[model samples]
Target: MSDAQRICLGAIAGAFGVKGELRLKSFTSEPEDIAAYGPLESEDGALSFEITLTGQSGKGALIARLSGVNTKEQADALRGVRLYADRGRLPALPDDEFYHADLIGLEVFDTGGAPLGRVKAVLNHGAGDLLEIHAPGMTASVLMPFTREAVPTVDLTSGRIVADPPEGLF
Candidate 1:
């Protein structure tokens, strides 16, 4: 899919209750806002769903109901399905904030314009997001902390990032 078309907001964990309720794992900064983007579509664009937040559940997930999902078995069948919203439906971010989708695939470069790698993914595990760069000439990908000190500049227009990685992290 083209990067401009969609942004993955979350996944359907499974059916929450018997009455079509789904366990939604939201990837938004405000978990509850996942429903505001309107109907979410499957990756293949074959299926689409409108989310209605019923309430909050364990692990900060939301118990939601999707249109056309009425049975526990039906919801169970959607487990592990990633949900995406149209790019235009999402709100614009502040200057310093960026959607992970926008960062993925951006090229990475050192201060001297040396190619480092391409961004494979952006990860956040309690700490801020880290840029997982798929550097060539390396056995494994490099995990560079996505901090201002490390990633000094991100030029989305150029589709590249200028990084001042920590010593020996290149």
Candidate 2:
């Protein structure tokens, strides 16, 4: 799918209860707002579900009911599934901010125009975002800090990022 089509909004944690309730982890700044965009679909768009806010669970989680899910087994089958909303429904981002979807697959380069790699994934472990880049001739991808100092420039329009990696990091 094109980058302009799908924007990830949330993820399914697992089944909350026997009645097909789901433990949802919303990625929106205002978590509850995820339901405003409309029905969410899986990455492949093969599965679609209308989400309803049931209540708030512990630790920034929401209890939700999927339109067609009526059994715990059905909900369990969806654990770890990411939810995407139509990109048109999402708001525009500020200049310095970027969606994880937009960052993935962008070519990364050093300040001197040396090819580093393409961003394979964007990861956040409750600290800050990391750009996982898989460079040529490397066995594994390297995690580069997304900070301004480390990554001097990000030209989304051109699908390129200029990174100033630390000593011996590349």
The superposed Cα distance between candidate 1 and the true structure at residue 98, in angstroms, equals 1.4
Number of clashing pairs per prediction, in order: 0, 0
Lowest summed lDDT window (length 10), candidate 1: 1-10
Off by over 4 Å in 1: none
lDDT of 2 by residue, 18-98 (tens): 999999998887889988988999988999999999998876689999899999999999999999988888999998988
- Give the local distance difference test score of model 1: 0.92
Whole-model lDDT per candidate: 0.92, 0.92
Model 1: per-residue lDDT, tens digit, 1-170? Answer: 67567999999999997987989999999999999988899988899998999998867778999999999999999999999988888888887788899999999999999999999999887788899999998989999999999988999989999999999987
Model 2 reaches what TM-score against the true structure? 0.91
lDDT for 49 in candidate 1 is 94
Give per-model TM-scores. 0.92, 0.91
Cα RMSD (Å) between model 2 and the true structure?
Answer: 1.7
Assess candidate 2 and give its lDDT. Answer: 0.92
